[model samples]
Target: MKFSKRTKLNIILLWVFTALPMSIFLYYYYPSQPIDWSIFMLMVLLAIATTAIPIYIGNVTIFFSQWVTVAAFLAYGAGVEMILVQLSILPMIFRVLFLQDLPYRLIFSSWMFIMVSFLSASAAHIAGYQIGSMDTIQILLGATIFMFVSLLSNHVILYSRERILGQKEKFFSRDALWDYAAGLVTLPFAVALYVLQLTMGWLAFPLLGIPFLLITYVMRMYNTAERANIALAKASAFGHELADRLSVEQIVNMFLEHLKNLLPADNIYIIDNLKGNYVVMRALEDGHEMRIDVPSDTIKNSFIHYYFTYSEKQCYVKSSEWVHEAPDFLKNDMNSLLIVPVHRNKKTEGLIILTARKKYAFEKFQLDIVHLLATYFAVSLEKAKYVNAAVEKSETCALTGLHNYRFLNKTLEIEQNRLNSNPHLILSALMLDIDHFKQINDRYGHHAGNIVLKDFAKLIQKNVPEDAVVARYGGEEFVIILPQYTKEEATKIGEKVRQTVEIHPFLVDSDLTKNRLDEIIYITVSIGVSSAPEDTDETMSLLRNADRALYIGAKQAGRNKVAEYLK
Candidate 1:
């Protein structure tokens, strides 16, 4: 209903171009005979009826009104034919106005129909078409020229419009071919209808109208079934892709990517509820991923909360249906919306929101497809969570929550291979031991020793660089693997660890004292450092040298100290 300044200008220009020439032509070429009002009204009705139901081929909609127009032209003249053609476009314009956001299409379609009718009629008149004279060869020749010009002019206008709009589309496509073929096939029917009208009078309408309506109905059914089949196939393939993903992030990305292919959307949002707190996991605007932080109050005020709380899937064909309840985050010039709650075992886990800039942008079938995709996402997320937990249990130390010996060995091999590939790179290893660890267990209890070990792992993790790999080697011993560290750097890190551990307090239960109060005791660690190519090239040998230095260099000389491999 509201048009921008540019659209108003285009509509004015289009109307002038269409109406001005048409008025001048009609004034100059007025029919000499008096018009038959009843017959003309009947022809108008037939044309309007045909325009109401169109057969779709790909992106093109083929209307059967061409035959009715041809019959009208033959019975009357080009002037009347042009008028009827313009009037017939009203149904399609109304359809678009109510169902889409493309108001410019109203004037554009009018302009296209006016030009096509005028130009094609002029061609037929030039080819010796005359009202009230029905000769077989001349009629055929004139109708053929008219149909050919009509099809060609339509494509020319369409291609020009597409090019002006910056679209890369060829003038002739399979849809165009279908249009031409349909026109040719209906030419004879037009002639037959005109001939039948001369004999059957008004009864000739149903003779042709009934069969055309039937064909349109059948084609509509077929197109619906075909679309449903294609959607199912695409959904199945998308489910397979989701199943192959191994992480929640991967699944979210894949869902967004495929959902865009399934429908036209201007924005997408993935909102997850983690322990009763709503968080925006992912967002995409205009097909590009974006980071957005929405306040909790805004989400609570929006329709997302309603959907999540009720576990309902909703589709809004117009903004008015939801604008009253929408928060600031949902008021982004969007008109249509589809929100589906992600459910797992009858509990809502998250919500998926898709929005478009046009009315009726999302259909019912698309909503169904999104529901199926949500199910697929929930299943894949559960599978990935369990798979990651299983993998972590295999590679992690249960007591200290650090990498176990198995992971340590695997990491060493990987670091050694990386060092071998780059001559300039260096790998460092640190072997650390808690000095007199058994004495604490004997004095207090083994439970106290376990607490010390856990606390020591936390301290080591806090001191090391994030990229460094720290693992519980065995007992009170631990290993650290540092990539790209020299021997001197590793020794400096080892000294830092030794100093921190010697001054740190370890909390333990006073079992031998038989007191309710827990006691804090001091502990010390001996550390040894070794580097690749400086100590030995092999990974295990580097570890062995660091271990030898920990016992012989540090443990033998002092209780708590840093030592480097002698070799």
Candidate 2:
């Protein structure tokens, strides 16, 4: 998706607003005194926090903001002894939130660019302010030292993160965190240089602490970045393992398993449907055990309503969100659950309901992982549904979506092949045809004839016995094979089908393509039924006899009627 021109313009405007104020504040908003060392650390922490806020804004998750705030606040106490200025954490923030898992040198280069940009703007602003009438060189040089340390510390942290993940890049090529702790390394050297310059009576001695502070900031940022990457790697690895085992059950169990990980006292289950009856599939009360299927829709729907209603927020499965008959296993065992519907192709297919055994047993990250797993579950379920539909299609008629001739043939063979040996097994078949079907096609049109055929199919379907096989044989002709049926039973069913089609009207178009829906027309059919005899051998012979009886019924009754072949 392309961002609109207006949206692109607005984002640029917002970036300028944050960057300009930060630059101006760093340049001119200091106290009028020579130095306040205590507040230096505080101001550095504040600067880093301001920088990190944007990074957090980009990541935009509750957990992301929380962890970033904690890490950036901790980075303030780094390298302040060596560098007179406080350590800045802006670069680490960018690496963690924007350019993730990159080389240390690349991270440092990006940080160097950011720091130089900020320092240059701040230096210019400070010169514009005319503070104490000092030359511009004094402020620029001081900002330059801070900029170097900030860049170094940013590199160290980025390297540390890469090292924890067992990855080596150009900057993170070293195995040890100490090698990349440039912020800490530069701190001692900068302090020593500043001391040497001060003892030798140089004018720049007092500002060398900025370099020391820069180095320590780099050291701390590297440490924090490395630790976060380690934790993130572990979290990701665990997720992969869970997903590898993910089924309809494992996917749901994973969410319920993490209630203790979230807060505590959380349980979860899936009911089969969201809007219909309750079909519970999996439940977790004691440990991470799971079955093959999820719960019923009745229980699942309660969670679905909750999920759709509270999509904006992470939800817990509460008693209020569920129905009265939640589940015998889940009822009274837990109080609340967070419902996450497993959706595929934009519609909910299953539900992931996590219950809170205690208050807020699940945190935000738990919900995130569950949502991810839902996608995988949906894919698996879709495969299962497709396999079932394919199996059904193999046996069904392509035109009418009913049992095809192949299945009917197989059914007749099975019934007769056994009946010949048993001598007691009875079988019957009805050969039926639409009366004057060709005349109707000529009178109305082939299109009307098609409607008549489809309706005729439905008519036979409604009248046939549950065990009977009804199939289209050819144009306007059909066959009904009934196993374990005597001649009398077959004749009764033939009559039922004969009457159903005789009364049921079908829409047929007129000669001029007029509306068929308005016109009503009736069609009749003749049926010939024949039962298996103890001496009967060939199935085709029985079919021939029934077909002959059908011709006789049509000629004698002169209307819709059924004729049975006598034994």
Candidate 3:
């Protein structure tokens, strides 16, 4: 495929910035100049430095991260000093080209300040070299002009940068090359204009400094782009590797740890949704170490309220604006924060906030990545919930609504899993039988018997605790898995079930005649209750005992009563 016009233009611009100016700077400085070796070295240094101007102008003002900016500036400055000492203003070339022949104001300010600095040094060493009055006035006038131009340049540079450069952005090779050319081509011209102004009188033109500024801008673009690429590649590789190796909880923690490496924030917090309450899993303040805490219920409630109110967009509260935005909870303490709403299947799940010591510490891209990771976490959590639900379902019976035979085994599994935390707790299993249910089906049609079973089941359901698990064992029999209850407690539940079923008339009238369909009837049920084994090894014996008690209750004299199984 053919490249687009923009891509072609960028390619052309890169070659020009990278190759053309370096060739020209080389032609002037080689072979014959005094201290040619030193001059060429300085030229090389300046050429390298010129390419960093774009990044400096774009990123420095907003992030206020002076360390890297200063590093790049120094590198550029030293390179210019070695490669093209006299002609260090390489931004002028691009200022004439890309900027529509209009000069960037930074060029004028930067040059003017240097000129003033030189003049100040000269004036300090003047030793009262009294010039004529006219010359003195001319010198003062020139100084004033330079200072005013420099101040204007400063303002223009700031405004231009803020409007032109976006937040948390990365640059590419094509853009970087443009910056390199701008800085390289303009360095000579910028120096000439400054030196010429000092040598030649009122005839000098300051606008000539703009082309050099443009070159500076281009150089910065290159350096910034290069750094961004390196950072992204490293983050991607590390994140992928870490994600693969770590467990789910560790991955969550690593994600929290990695946010600081990519973005700037004063504080980072991870609040997990634990039963409708926010549990602060981790907190980062400044660049210091992180702290983990299980906060109070009140604190969790505060977080829930905060999230419910502002879980859509992001909440950024400045120190000055804190009183207005979060007067109650923030209470004038928060500086600035980014609040992102985490979602799953269009439902709000939780909220995340990354705060900055300064105002507006977050960018859309940073927030996007952060939220993207959050989405992954949301999906993982959703999967975990489904798994837990499935596990719970497997432990109980689906039909007859009572647990199946496997339930006794699962009860032991849970008890083992509980780690003996609560020894005071007791569990019981109650097996119930519809007395002579099969014989009734033989005598009174099975349809009538089915009604009896369902009616008796309803009575048992009403009498048992909400926590009780009641399910049909098979035809004519059922079971109840009762937790935190002893034999006496199980007896109470069983006895109540027996009495309710024996008295509650299932049918209003009997069908002693030939198959009367409108017959109302009553039924009796027998329940056998057994306690859980105190020792883990005795679980099987406990279940067998419970089953035997059920048979005993069936054989007992009373038609509707409860029986306890003793070891």
lDDT of 2 by residue, 321-409 (tens): 45464544554535455556667677555566666543333445545656665555566556646765776688786766567767766
From the highest lDDT down, the ranking of the candidates is: 1, 2, 3
- The regions of model 1 sitting more than 4 angstroms off are 1-67, 70-85, 94-109, 122-133, 174-203, 302-304, 405-446, 465-469, 477-495, 510-520, 526-567
Sort the candidates on TM-score, descending order. Answer: 1, 3, 2
All candidates: TM-score: 0.79, 0.39, 0.45
Model 3: per-residue lDDT, tens digit, 1-567?
A: 234556456545544564345434433432122233443343334443443343433233211111111211122321222224224334433222312112323233343333333332234224332211125444344333323332344334444444554433333333434443433443344334334444553233323324444644655566556655655565666555554532456556666677777666656776666566555566676655565555446554454456644566565545554344432333243466676767767856566667765444554555656666666666655665676567657755554444555665666568544435665667787877887777677666766676676666677788899988776677887777787787898889888888887778776222344656566556677777787654222445555666678777554656576878855
Per-residue lDDT, model 2, residue 153, is 54
| lDDT agreement with native, every candidate | 0.82, 0.54, 0.52
Candidates 1 and 3 compared: the better one by lDDT is: 1
Error of 1 at 65 (Å): 4.3
Q: Which regions of candidate 2 are displaced past 4 Å? A: 1-269, 272-329, 333-341, 346-348, 352-377, 387-403, 410-427, 465-468, 500-507, 512-522, 532-545, 548-561
